[model samples]
Target: MATEHGIPKLRIVEPSFDSPLTSVIIDLEKLRDNRLDSKTHPGIFFQIKHIFQLLESLGSARIEGNNTTIAELVEKEISGSRNDDEIIGDDEINEIRNAERAMDFIESRIKNNSKIDQAFILNLHKIVVE
Candidate 1:
């Protein structure tokens, strides 16, 4: 494979059924480089940025608001502990619905042998969590 933009070559190892599954250590730096060009692609950016922003905001919120607001938000975001009527805004509710729809779509695609990757999962996570 050819390297692009200082990107390292991808190392794909195919294992035989006779052999035990071998370790395939991934180089995160290479992975990052491979995906860098997708930042401009809205589909990829939507999910990646959502996670990145959520994490960044949570970090910032802790520094600024400390445990009070940040903790509550984190709990509400992760679990269904929060009262839906109060905590879930209009947009957030829509996001949840959209996430479910996207997941279903992905399942269907994979069933039909037309599947997506990180972009799909990222979008789903972003929708539900962010």
Candidate 2:
């Protein structure tokens, strides 16, 4: 891979299945399968998914230097926006919102069996930027 400025971008390949990292992958997969197979109520599962989406948004924004806390995210979500005196910037909030929306968009794509490729990625990017 290469950067937009034409610099080569180093890609990290996954560890071989025989490596110690493979055990982590196996454990995670088993945990995921167990969660999916559990007899949780639909509403409870929905809430779990919602919470995870928030965390996903939080982590994504943090990578870009967004300092919004999970508590603030919940408050902003409840109020639909923040006041002028709020410490967080509008752009930061928007980034978090975009990340959350992107996750939803991906979920929908997967549900609809949409092709996952460059176009799909670009579409997600367009959704996030817009």
Candidate 3:
């Protein structure tokens, strides 16, 4: 089946334990298990996560040809102003906001052990495009 973007639907493949890449995967898992714990306070960690989400949204917008910089977005956000000129258009700002809304939708809908399916992806696409 084809997706809205005309790409083939994703097929989940199970990895064989005997594959040559198995050892590399096992090593990565071990590294993940041995990772150091964060020393930041929970509140600070949450703030950092929020900042990362904003950065991620900006990066996604940039990938889609939105040239608005992080500083421009942050300044607009802080000032609550929307007087964008030739450099940054309203559509560009809206694209970043839509990406952020998509992230929020994922956070609110998804939980531990939740399965992401085609419906979820389509809903996410709707959020990003709206």
Q: How displaced is residue 111 in candidate 1, in Å? A: 1.7
TM-score of every candidate: 0.27, 0.67, 0.68
Residue pairs with backbone overlap in model 2: none
Q: lDDT per model, in order?
A: 0.53, 0.81, 0.81
Q: lDDT by residue for model 3 over 1-130, one digit each (tens)?
A: 7685887777776679998788888889889768568889989999889899889999999998989998888888788574322224478888888888888878877745456877889999998887
Model 1 regions more than 4 Å off: 1-10, 13-89, 115-130
Which structure is stronger by TM-score: 1 or 3? Answer: 3
Model 2: per-residue lDDT, tens digit, 1-130?
5685675666876899899898988888888656346688989999998888889889988998889998878888788565423434578787887777788899999989999877998989986775
Cα-based lDDT at residue 100, candidate 1: 43
List, in order, the clash count of every candidate structure.
Answer: 0, 0, 0
Summing lDDT over every window of 10 consecutive residues in candidate 3, give the lowest-scoring window: 80-89
